[model samples]
Target: MQDLVNLKVISLFHSENLVRIPELSSATKLELINLAYCRKLLELPSSLQHLEKLTHLNLRWCKNLRFLPSLYKATSLTTLILSDCSNLFSFPEVSPNVRELQLEGTAIEEIPSSVESLCQLISLSMEDCARLKNLPTSICNLRSLEVLSLNYSPNITTFPEMSRNITELNLQATAIEEVPSSIECLSNLCVLNLARCRRLKSVSTSIHKLKSLRGFYLRDCSRLEIFPEILDTLERLRNLDLSGTALKELPSSMENLIGLRQLRLENCESLVCLPESFHKLKSLWFLYVYGCKNLVIWPDNLFSAIGGASLTGRVEMQKDLHGLSSLKELDLSGTNLENLPTTIKQLTRLQKLILWKCERLKSLPELPPSLIHLDAHDCTSLAEVSSITKLFEQALLCKDKPYTPKTLACLFTNCFLLDQKVVASPGTPKLQMLFGHMFTILKDYHQASPQRNMFTTCFPGSEIPEWFDFKSSGSSINIQLPSEWYYNRHSMENFPGFVVSAVVSFQDYFDDAHFHIRCECHLKSCNGDCPNLSCSFTVWSRRGLHGSRLLGSDHLFLLYHNELVRRFVETQASNKCIYKEASFEFYPGVWERNWSQCISCEVKHCGVHLLSAATDDAEVQPPKRYKYVS
Candidate 1:
C-alpha cells in the first residue's frame, strides 16, 4: 500500500476497532475516502490534508470519532458528510467549493460565522442538532446558498435573516416563537416549511409580499391559532397547508388567494366556522377538512351564486356562493354537517363527493349530474336514498347532448335504508325505477350494438321478472329446443335471435371471489350414449355496501353457443327418431372450496328471448316436464 501513491478511491467501511487509520501520507492523488460505520474508529490521520486533489470524504456513523481537522486548502473537495458522529462536537472550516454539507444528529452547539466564507455553498443542514442555539447572521451573506434546514433544533429560538437567493427553508420542530417581519427580505424564496413548530404562536402578515412563494407547509403547528390577514397580495401562491393546527377560524383573506389550488385543514378540531368569501375562490380545486368536528356552518347563501337551484323547502336558505364553478373536489368527512346545501347540486363539473362517517347527515339534496364517484361509506344516519336514484336518472338522461354520456361510480357500503318506515312502499318503487333504468340502459346498448351481449344486475327482489321464459325453484333447469324452433325464424336467413336471462342470490361476500355458471347442451341417444357441447360464464363479486343479496340479471352467453346449436341441428338431421327433445342443463358454482356454504343462491329463474319486430311481447313457454303453478 505504501507504493500505491496514485490511488484515487479507498473504502474501508464497517471495520471494528479500527482506531487508527494506516499511514497514507504519500497518496497525493486520493480524491475520495469512505470509512462509514467504523464503530471503533477514533480519528483520521492528520496526513489526510496532504491529498491536494481530494474532493469527497465520508465518515458517517463513525461513532467514536472526536473531531475533524481543517480542510481550508483542499479546494477540490465538493461533498463532505460527518453525520451521526455523536462524540464529535464541532466541524472545522469546510472548503469553499463544497456544495453539500450534513451534520445531523450531532452535539454541535452553533454554526460558525466563518461558514460565510464558503461562497459556493448551496445546502446546509443541521437537523437534530439538539444543542444548536442560533444560526450566524453572516449566513445571509452566502449569495449561492439555496437551501437551509434546521429541523428538530429545539433550542433555536430566533430564525435569522437568510440569503435572498435561498429558495427553500425548513425550520420544522424548532423553538422559534414567531417568524420575524424580516421574512420579507427573502424575495426569491419559493418554499417555506414550519411544520410542527409548536412554539410558533403567530406569523407576520407581511409574509404575503413573498411574490414567488408557491408552497407553504405549517402542518401540526399545535400552538398556531391564526393566519396573517394579507392574502390578497399573494397572487403567485398556489398551495398552503394548515393541517393539524389550532386555528379557531379561517380569515376572510384566505378567500383572496385566487391562484391557490389546494388547502388542507385536517384535524383542526377547534375550527368553528368557514367564511362566506370561499365562493370567491375560483381556482380552488381541492379542499380537505376531514377532522374538523366543531365546524358546522359553511358559507350562507352558497346556492344562488353558483347557479344551483336551491330549494331548501324545510331548511332556511341563504346565498353566499358567488364564483365556485371551477371547484372540482370537496371533502366533508367526519364533520358535524346534518344536511347538504341544495347548491351542491349545482356544481356541474364536480366529479367526487366524499361524506364518509358523517353520523348526523340525514339526507342529501339533488346531486350534480357530472358526479363520477361518491364515497358515502359508514354514513349510517343517511336516510333518504330517493335523491340518489334521481341523481342516477339525471346523469343517464344527459338529454341535451344525447350522444355524449357520463359514467358514475358510487360506494354506499353499510348504508341505511332510504325510508325505513315503510319497507315495501319506498323500496318497491325505487327498486322498480332502478331496474327500469337498468333495462333501458341495456336496451339502448343493444340498439347501439345488436350482436354484443347485454348484461345488467339488480337487487330488486328474489322473484324473477315476469319476462323470463322459464322460472325454476331449484338450481338446475332443462330447456328442450324443438326442431321447428329454428325453422320458424324471425329472420329470412332462418337464424333464431334469442337472449338468455338468469337470477342468482348471493349468500356471502368475498373481496375477490368468483362464481361460475355453465350451460351444457347435451343429447342422450337411444343407446344410452351422450354427446354434449358447453360454454361457461363467470361472475366476479366485490364487497357490497349492503349485505349479500339475490340478483336478477339479463345474461347473454353459454346457452347460445353456435357449436351446441350446430351439433343439435346436425344430430337432428341424422336421427330425428332418437328423441325429439334436447336437454339444456344450467349449473351454478362458486370455486369448489366455497361452494358448500353458497348453495342458497341457486339459479331460481332461467330463460331465452326469441326476437321479432311484430312480437311486442315474447311469449314464455312452459317446459314439457315442469308444472307451472301460479
Candidate 2:
C-alpha cells in the first residue's frame, strides 16, 4: 500500500464492508478516488485534505458515511459527488477551485457557508434533499454560478436572491409562496421551473426584465390565480407552460413577447378567454389549450385588445392580425361553445388545427390556403364541411417551394356528412421485391400538389372510380406481372403504379360507423412456395351507427405499397420463374369469415391494370415458366 503513492485512479467501489478510508496523506499524485456504493464506508480520513492534487472524489450511495474531511485544502478539487448518501448530514468545506458539487438525494441538512465564497463554482445541485430548508444568501453573490437546482426539496419555502448569471433554476414541488421582485434582476436567466409549487400564489411582475428568458414552467400551481404582467420585457421568451394551473386568464400584455413560439395551457379548467394580444404574436408557432372546457369563443376582434396601450408602457400592439403568418400548429380540443369566428381563416400559414370532440360545432368555415392538417373527430353534431375539392387546390397551386403537407390521416374520421370514393392498388415487380403492398388507391395519385400526398373524406359511391387500372366483377381476383418487369430500369423510374378497384357493400349499417378492412395478398412463386402479406386499415364513413339502408353501400379505396416484397422477388425468385400468381382477400374487422360486407359483397368488379403503357418494352402477357430452365 505504501508504493501506491503515484496511483492516479483508485476505485474501491462496491467494497460493501469497507469501514474507513485508509490514510492517503502520502498519495499526493492521486487525482480520483471512487468509493461509490461502498455501503459500509463509515468515514473519510481527515488526512484526505492533504491530497493537494486530488481533483475528483465520488462517494455516491455510501449510505453509512457520516462525515467527510474539510476538502478546502484540496486546492485542485474540481468535482465532488455525494449523491444518495443517506447518513451524511453535513457537507465539508470545498475549495474555491471546485466547479461542480452534487449532493442530490443526500441527508445533508445544511450547506457550508463557504459555498458563497467558491468563486469558481458553476453548478450546485441538491435536489430531493428533504430536510434542506434554505440556501445561504451569500450564494447569491456567486457571479459565476450558472445552475442551482433545488427541485423536490419540500422544506425550502423561500429562496434567496440569486446570481444574475444563473441560466437555469429549478424549484419544483417546493413550499415557496412567492419569489422576490429582485428576481427580475437576473437578465441572463433562460429557464425557470416552479412546477407544482402549490403555495406559490404570486410572482414578481418585473420578470419581464429577464430579456434572455426563453422557457418558463409553472404547471400545477393550484393556488396561483393571478399571474403578474410582463409589460414588454422578455423579447426572447419562447416556451411557457401553465398547464393544470388555476389561472382564469392571462395578462393582457403578452403581445410584446414577439419571440414566443409555444404556450401550453392544457387542463386549465378555469381559463375562459385568451387575450386579443394572442392574435398579434406573429412569431408564435404552437399553442395548446386542450381540455379548457370554459373556453367557448375566440373574440371576433382577436387582433384588438382592450386597454392595449395601458397594458404595456411602450410596445404598442399592431392594430391588425393578417393571420398568424408564422404560426404552424394550434390545439383546442374538448370545448363546448359553437361556431368559430370568421377571422379564423386569417391564419393563412397554419398547418394543423386540432378541434377534436367539439360537440356543438355544426359547420366548418372557409379553410386557409396554407392549412393542411385538420382534426375535428367526434363532433357528433357537425353536419357540414366545406367543399372537399377546394381542399387540395391551394396545395396544387404552390409547388415551387418547400411545404409541410397537412396530415392526410383520419382527417374526417367520424364526420358522417362527408362521403368517399374508393380505389384498390396492385403490386408491381419492384413492389413485389420491396415490401408487400402499396395502398396506391389512397395515395394522391392524380393530384400534382406536393402538399396533398393523401386524401380522406366521405364520398357518395359504392362503385370504384372509373380511373382504376384493371376492372373486375368478383370478390377476389388474380393478376400476373408483366414479362421481364425487373429487366427494364425504366419500369420503376417512369411507372406510377398498378391501380386495383373493388366495390364494398355498405348497404347494412353496423352499430359503429367505423369499419376495419384487412387486405391479404398471397403470392404463388415459381419455386413452389407461397407467401402471404396482409395489412389492415380502419376507415370511417358517413354510414350512421344506426341508420336506414337507404344510404346503400359506402365505396372505399386505399393505396398500398410494401418494401420486403420488391426485394424478395428481385433477388429470391426461382431460376425457372417467368410468371407468378397473385391473389388478394379482404376481411372486415376481427371476423376472418366475414371477408366482404353484407352477407356477400356483390363484387362490382375486381381487376388490375399496369399504371403505364411500357408494354413497348415489356409485354403484360405471361411468359413460359421453363423459358429460363437449364
Candidate 1 regions exceeding 4 Å error are 2-6, 11-27, 34-42, 301-317, 387-408, 418-439, 442-630
In candidate 1, where is summed lDDT lowest over 10 consecutive residues?
305-314
Most accurate candidate by TM-score: 2
* Cα lDDT, model 1, residue 560: 26
Model 2 TM-score relative to the real fold? 0.70
lDDT of 1 by residue, 1-630 (tens): 477588999888888767878677888889999888888998787777666899889888988989787777778888888888888888667678888887888789888888889999998888888998898889989999998888998998897788889999989999989988889889999999999999889999879888889899899999999988875567777889998899988888877687888888888988866777777777878888877777655676455321111134223334644456876787777765667767777787687787767766776778887775676655767766556656654544555443343444454434434323354555454334443344444334323322322122223244543334444554444544444433222232233333444555444533234455666655554445556756455443333322333333222211223223433445443343343334455676666555433453556655543332232232322223433322
Error of 1 at 308 (Å): 20
Candidate-wise lDDT, in order: 0.65, 0.64
- Name the 10 consecutive residues with the lowest summed lDDT in model 2: 428-437
TM agreement with the true structure for every prediction: 0.68, 0.70
